[model samples]
Structures are given as C-alpha cells and as structure tokens.
Target: MTMREIAFSLVAVAGLLATATAKAQAPEPFGRPGASDAKGAIELIDPKVLRVCADPNNLPFSNRAGEGFENKLAQFLAGKLGKDLAYVYYPGATGFIRNTLNAHLCDVVMGMPQGDDVVQPTNPYYRTSYAIVTRAGADLDGLKTLADPRLAQKGRHIGLVANTPPGNVLARLGLLAAVKPYPLVVDTRVDAPGADMIHDLEAGAIDVAILWGPIAGYHVKRSNGRLVETLLTQEPGARMSFRIGMGVRHSDQEWKRELNRLIAQNQREIDRMLADYGVPLIDEAGAPIAVEP
Candidate 1:
C-alpha cells in the first residue's frame, strides 16, 4: 500500500493514541477551556517578567543552559517587552501544563502546538512539518515522501519515534514491522530521541530517519553536512504539518492578546531565530521557506 493508505489508516491509530494519551495525561481542567476570567480564575502575576515554563533538557527546543532555540526566543520576547527572562523548569510530559502553567509556576509555554486545549495559544509565529533525514548524496537523496516505493525496498530500515504521526504512517504502510521504533516517553535527563535517531542514521544503524522538522534540521546542521533533510510536505489527504505557538493559561486572555501582538510585530525576528536554529519553516500554503544561497 502507498502513503495514501497510510494516510487513511493513520487517523484511526492516531486518534486512538491521542485519545488515550490525553486521557491518561490530562490534568485538572485549566480554569475553563478557552476563555478565562482574568479577575477571578487567573492569578495576577508580575507582568514585568517573562516567566517561561519549559523542559530543562529538551534540546532544539529548551534546556537549563539557555542554549536551545526556545530559550533564545524567550530572551528575545523578554527583551522586546523590556522584562527580565525567568524560567520554571519541568519535564515536558504528562501534567507539564498542570504543574507549571496551571499551577502558576510560570506564565507561558514557549513552544506548544496551536489549538492545544491545555492553554490558550497566541497566533502562531511559524509552522513546520515532519522531515526525512538521510545521508547526503546517498541513494535516497531525492526521496521526498514516505510514499516513496524506495522506502519499501529490500534491506531498507527506517527509524521513527514511536506513537507519533510518522510512526502511524509507517505502521499502516506495513513498514513498522521492519522499522526500529524509538520510545516517545524518554528519560528527559538522559535521552533525546530526535538527536539519537540522527546519530543512529549517521552510524549506519538505520537507513533513514523520520523526525519533526525543527529537530531534524538542527541535528543535520550540527552534523557538519553529514546528513540531509527534506520536509515532508505531502500527505495525500492527511495532516502532516502543524503551526507552533506559545501558550498561556486559558484565563489569561489579556496575556494571550499581548503575546499575539508581539508575535505579529516581531515575526521577522522570530523567523530569523528559527532559521538560525535550522528550523524548517513552511508557508501556510505548505511550501518550504526559501533559504538564501
């Protein structure tokens, strides 16, 4: 079957997992879902500081050392607002939002998906898609999509984060039976699946690896041109791309609006930051963000 088949069956598998994970990971309702009462439900915190909640060891995204792109982005936002940047460290897994944002440990989450129910999202500053990583100038040089028949060829092995969209796609294509599935629930202190997948690809343990665009892009850059990445822009009637935005508590409408304004006003700067970190952004039309030669 082709990726079209993967596309069709993917919804079922994904929906099942999303539902299960959400239910299992769901924290207490965040003071209502969408709109929040600023005076009652929301706690008034110091608006002069950019208190960002983030995972301390999730790289290409965040870390305690202020080396990740999200940390840099936070610093930029804080600078724009003329506020000091502060962090509330938490593992980005189940109850992350509940324990951090909801509990008022911090004011914002710098890199969450748009439309996330746990918190209100600002207008997305950038959008990204899944990426395919392979050795540069290799036989898979021109491979663009998971639908490529070459992926099913003899002796081919694929690496993917288990229970993700790409993993669901591979499973539907009957490729998962041969693919090496990396655990999604990793120990934040030790493993970084995205970096690990790229490392495995470089070491010849896997033929190709499918990963989120930003993660793949960042590692490929750090790989010193040893690896190449192409954004997967086609899904044949499935969602493969997502818009990323910062999240605030649902009751923080004023805070969300202020952030939306900041995002719009500073989008160019934000895009530059993302590009510098090797995030593969795409236009709303699903075209790749052009890179200057």
Candidate 2:
C-alpha cells in the first residue's frame, strides 16, 4: 500500500527496478504498440494457454486459492479466450514482474496501475481511490479526508499505511501523533494489515482506517453491516485515485492488444465482477462507477 498501492514499493525494494518509477508525467519508454506489431509478435504468446503472474497471498487481488477478484477475472478471461489458465506464483514483493513476466514464466499481470513503465498496460478496466472505513453509524462515518477537523479532536485515532499519500496529508494536518501506522511492506504470506486494521477498528483500537479502495471495499463487504467504507475525495495534497489495467512485458505488444480486446468485450462483466467483490470503481471524471456499498 505504499503510494500507488502496488509495485512502487516493490520497485524500490528490488533495487534493480529500471522502470516502474513514479515519474507519471514522463511518457512511457515503451509506447502502445500499433496494429502491425500485433501480427509481428503474436507467436510469443501461447495460443492454447492463458498465463498470469500473481501474488500467492494478496487478497482482493490474487491468492493461490483463486478466490480473489483478480483470480476470478483471470479464469473468466481464459474461458473467453478458449485457453486453459496457468499461474506463476510470486510473493508480489521485489521482482514480481521480473521473476514472473520477464523470466517468461507468465504472460500477464491481472491488475496494476495503468501507466507502469516496466509493463505495457492494456486498456484500463477499473478505477479506484483511497477510502476511509469506519464502524457503521459511528460519529466518524461523516469523515471525508484525514484533513477533516474532526480527526484532530481529542482521542480520535486514524489508522493508515505508512508512507502512503494519506499519511502525508495527515502529517500536514498535524494529526500524525494520533495515527496508527501500518507497515507499507511486509510478508503478505504471513500478514494482512488491512484485515488487522478492520479487526482493530471493530475492537475499538482506532476510530477509522484509511485504506486503498479495493482493500477497504473487500473488508467492508465482509464486515456485514458492522463497518462502512467511503472514498476520500477531499484530500488536496495526495493523489487518492488510480485506474487499474492488465500488464504485460514491454515487448508483448500483440499480447497487450489481445488483452485490450478482452477488456473491451467484457467491460460490463468486469464491472459487475469488481462490484460484487466490493471494489470501489470510479470513472475518469472522479465519479463513482459500478461501486457497491
């Protein structure tokens, strides 16, 4: 959950990260492929199998059990493409893209920020934002951002991932002292901080949790009326929203286009799937889309 919420921390931690840097303003070193390249490199991908690189334990995204939304999406795509599905399981820590896609162990990444430099992204399928999760009907249910004056009130504690954009806004609001910070990176195989945060909130350890939208959405849906999640739209200094797309190696232009076609043809089904999983999807104008409570 560091900054962009995926791969940014991995890029830094891997040290060998040549791309995936936070320079979104810069053009992608590998631009989108033209229709001609689609025919040129179509052979690089297997015609009979759909391969995916994924974290073995990252919930709401992927897991070894094929229970996460991304896992479901991969299965759906594979069915549509008339191919058997395969997975390259990695820790999603450092070298996620390297050990999986670059090593030729997999063909696609199910979900990541649209403009990642290391991978050529297909058309974005969904958008989400950072959100605040709280116990239902609590006084803090009205929370919109960390900068809200109610957060500065006595005994009000906010839980957030350290080094994320929301953390920066809290610091500027002089609310850092009252924040319960979670680690930005950890062994996902053993830790689930977002779930832990929800547990703590229910147990009254913190008043609220500011989490990535997918994480918040999934957990809130499971909370069964005990908790409520809402997107944060009031923060000015931090970038709170992002669009997610499938990622492929930079050389796999034709594969990228194929994925894009799948995305275009299945967008309605994709939106419904994401909503069922409690993903807080939004449109380009910052308006919500296919989002469920």
TM-score, cand. 1: 0.85
Model 2: C-alpha RMSD to truth?
5.2
Off by over 4 Å in 1: 1-44, 291-293
lDDT of 2 by residue, 106-127 (tens): 7787876765766778888987
Question: lDDT per residue, candidate 1, 1-293, as tens digits?
Answer: 33322222211111101111121233344453333444322433555667888777777777899988889999998899888889998765556666777777788878766655556678988888778999997899988888899999988989877656676667667787669877665446576677778789999999898877777888888888889998887765346787778877766776788889899998888888989988888999999787552
- Each prediction's whole-model lDDT (CA): 0.70, 0.72
Best prediction by TM-score: 2
Model 1, position 54, has a per-residue lDDT of 76
Model 1 residue 166 CA deviation (Å) reads 1.6
What are the TM-scores, per candidate, against the unseen true structure? 0.85, 0.86
Checking candidate 2 for backbone clashes, the offending pairs are none
